[model samples]
Target: MSSLFTPLTLGSITIPNRIGMSALTRNRSTGTVPNEIMLKYYVQRAKGGAGLIGLNGPNVLGFGIKFRSKAGGKLPTLSMKLEVKFMLSFGIVSLTLIPVFLRPIIMLAAGVPVYAPSAIAAQGGRFRLLPGEPGYVTPTEIADPTPLIAQFKQAAINAKEAGFDGVEFHGANGYLVHQFLDSTSNHRTDQWGGSPENRARFALETLKELIAVWGPDVSLKLSPAGGYNDMGMPLQDTIDTFGYLLREVDNMGLSYVALVRFDEEDDGPRGTAHDVVETFRPFLTKTALFVNSSVTPAEGEELVKSGKAAGVFMGMNWLTHPDVARRIKEGKELDNAPDFKSFYGRGRC
Candidate 1:
């Protein structure tokens, strides 16, 4: 029996297998609310045999970005109720909802300025427009993160009310939390910035808030080596910052920590830690570590068998094959390749 098919305990919930589905933002939500199509999407993955399913929450408190859609909408409570209810009916997987704060150019049109730890602007990319572009704007430095922390706390309450098994904090991929963690994006002289400890304050504080509500059931996703959304720090700075952050998280006794591997082919400054899991594995003493990004089933099994990762989370594989876990366990071939062109936008769901 492959280790990937073995059970793993996460906080109060136990996943039947080590193969889990990572959160893939399918922007199929109706505005900021999750529609029936989105619910059906999650249910299919749960039935396909994912031991753990990570779902992205809709915009929270009108502060997060809505991909290619209008902002200022909250994740409807009813949507969570319905999605959790249907997914739990299968009784085969544990569900976790991710609360993310992403800022894109579209939020500017919604009268919301991009808020971050500093006023730095992200460089242009295929998905992001240049600073001189029509809607591009440098982020507004948040003087006080109290309200933002409150919003995440409320999101946790909402998740518990909706019967989710756990909550995953989106602290990776250059989102609000990631912005605060990286020195390149955060240049504040205040308590929230400057030193590595200060740079990790926002994320640690926010995790405290979530843990207060969900206890040990809360997990975090981080891209320490990621250069996405124009995020990168000096090699030592990356180690000192994320190294400190991971040490603190290890003390919190959370359920798990999912790390996103850096892509060598990506165009941007790379972080010091190229092999994210191997680099930070030493800092995580008690927490179960989950690794993501382009992981294959065979590799995933080896990661578990070798004890480098407690589980493996695959995005594109899960998106393309609903039965990804079973396929990996049985050594069956996967379905057709993912349609990258149709990854976003509606109509596919």
Candidate 2:
């Protein structure tokens, strides 16, 4: 049997298989609230045999910052009302029908006048909004991150009350948390910048708050080698920063950590490490590690079999093929072709 079909345990939760669904922002919500379409989408995936289903975006706390869609339209920020509705809807569905573990990827704001450890503008061109554009604004250096940390704590409390299996912090893909971790985006002189320890302070503090609410049920998503959102530091800096962060996370004894691998196809500024998982795997001695980014079932199986990853998280594959896990188990081919044109919209796929 393929290792991908084998069960894996993370802290107290046990997934039936090693093929988990990575969080993909489908934008199917009505305003900030998730509707029937979103519910059906997750239910189908769970019923199709995903061991774990990760929900993204609408579950994120926007901190009143408006997000822009791929077509340059303003996306609604998440409100407590919508958050509760989202959690209840998915939570109830998971409890009743699907035995799959449902984890929402909670993110900090990612929009206009972006908040960061320092006031740096993302590099422009090709999928990124240029300077002076409607959505482009240099980040506002956060004088105090206390209020923001409180928002994360409250978000965790809501998720726990709503009965989610766990919550994954969106500390990846150059969002606010990632911005703080990356030296290029975090050039502050305060206690939250300069050295790698100071840089990791924000993420650690926020994760501590979440842990206080949910204990080991909390997980984190990281992209140490991701160049998306114009984020990349020098090679050694990347190693030192994430290496230190991973050691700390391992000590916390969290459920798991998901790492996004470097994209060879991306034309943007690439991070130092080409194989992100391999580079940082040693630091994560105790916590279960999941790898994402264009990974295939065969490769995922290899990773699990080789003890490199506890599971594999698929994004596009899960989105395109609802029964992706079953197909992998049954040795069926996946629908590799994804409709890029219809990737994002406020409608059913």
Candidate 3:
């Protein structure tokens, strides 16, 4: 039985412990950038000895330079995969890159995979960022990812080159990638729209770029079966799309995969984590498995022991409990809830 404190490797990085600070959106970064506040937050978790520290919130692709990352021959999984000389330390999985997504609900409504380069009002009222906003904008005017993807890749490379572990692609949440993956938000009929493969094309492109810089020690946070953001793909298609990604990506030297089975709301005691893991197991090999959504130390223990996932990601929990790693190891109790106010709103930690 592997303890929560046991070390696990994802791609090239080996976490000090299994307690990871899963990425959470803190209003610290501007223009989808990581600022000093964000840096301090991660440092705090690292000092706490959390296994891994993933960047919280926003994947910027438009301001980056693109690279062909998958050519490293299925990228090798080194004992210290992405660790470098002098830099911020990270674990097996390093979450980066904001994927343009397609909400299940939005996809169901539009009958296709929604694609967005930015948060544009494509479908209707609920689609708009602000209240009562209308219709979607042109993909070009709304989002020119050519630039952002480049920036995203550079960011990942910087993290890795800086001596941190691998990077995690932020594919979940209603971010840019999420908007596109969901049909409700994306109504385009171009090569990047209509079909599932086409919808997945952009993501594939982003993945390839990240691999070019960070190699295969990468992980993606996907909601293929994610119910939040109104994901509406049929069981089969959801399975099919993920199958395609697994086949295409895993072979390219993927370190592991992290799936968000349900909306954050559906987590907790509902067995959402277990159920989602079951859904993914059929398609994956020995790749590291991770589940992030309101994870408790006890819950994480059960998950690892049950073989549901290889690692656990603590979101707001890790923020409040810097000593969470210590508590779990010492058999001490953890703070279930955190000081919400301090978690967000820039400045000092």
Evaluate all candidate structures by whole-model CA lDDT and list the values in order: 0.70, 0.69, 0.54
Q: Write the per-residue lDDT of candidate 2 for residues 180-275, one digit (tens) a residue.
A: 888888888888899999999988999899889878778888888858767788878989999999999999978889999887654255665568
lDDT of 3 by residue, 108-213 (tens): 2343323343334332213233345433333332344456567567667655533445677766654455545655445557766666676666667877887887
lDDT, model 3: 0.54
Task: Give the residue spans of candidate 2 off by over 4 A.
Answer: 62-113, 125-135, 346-349
User: Which one is best on lDDT?
Assistant: 1
| Predicted structure with the largest TM-score when compared to the true one | 1
Give the Cα-based TM-score of candidate 1 against the true structure. 0.83
Question: What lDDT does model 2 reach?
Answer: 0.69
Which pairs clash in the backbone of model 1? none
lDDT of 1 by residue, 149-221 (tens): 8877877776665555777888887778888888888898989999999999988998899889888888988
Candidate 2: residue 330 lDDT (0-100): 89
Rate residue 21 of model 1 by lDDT: 83
